[model samples]
Target: MQESRLRWYGHIRRRPPDYDSNLALHLSLPSHRSRGRPKTRWKDVVLNDMSEC
Candidate 1:
């Protein structure tokens, strides 16, 4: 009985947990070290030039 239990333990140890868990720092590192904020284009900012008569 002890031998059988030891075999099961060895088998489980060989296989890791099914749930996937990655380091948060590894995933967010790219965004954290990215360039400055994107600039707004002239076309994106609309101006109101019409005056009421």
Candidate 2:
């Protein structure tokens, strides 16, 4: 599941910025203080996968 998801992410990354999927990929949500920990981002996931490779 994760591998397929990552592969799809790669496809999305290759798309032009005007594409909805690409826009969504680059979109940032409003920031607010959190209690314990910060969330893992898509970039982090991709970096982790690359490091493993």
Candidate 3:
């Protein structure tokens, strides 16, 4: 699981800056959360794996 996430992360990193998946990682949405705990996002998962290394 971690391996695949890392693979895709590298794949996205190699894309042009304007590519959607690449850009999505850095883009923040204008909307606010409804309430309760925030979701576990894709970047959050990748970051957790990276920190474990």
Best by lDDT: 3
Sequence-dependent TM-score of model 3:
0.85
In candidate 1, clashing pairs total 0
For candidate 3, the per-residue lDDT at 31 reads 89
lDDT of 2 at 45: 84
What's the candidate order when arranged by decreasing lDDT? 3, 2, 1
Q: What's the CA RMSD for each of the models?
A: 25.1, 1.7, 1.1
lDDT for model 2, please: 0.81
Best by TM-score: 3
1-53: candidate 2 lDDT, tens digit per residue:
56876798789989998999898877888888698887888777877876776
Off by over 4 Å in 2: none
Q: Could you tell me every candidate's TM-score relative to the true structure?
A: 0.31, 0.71, 0.85
- Candidate lDDT values, in order: 0.37, 0.81, 0.93
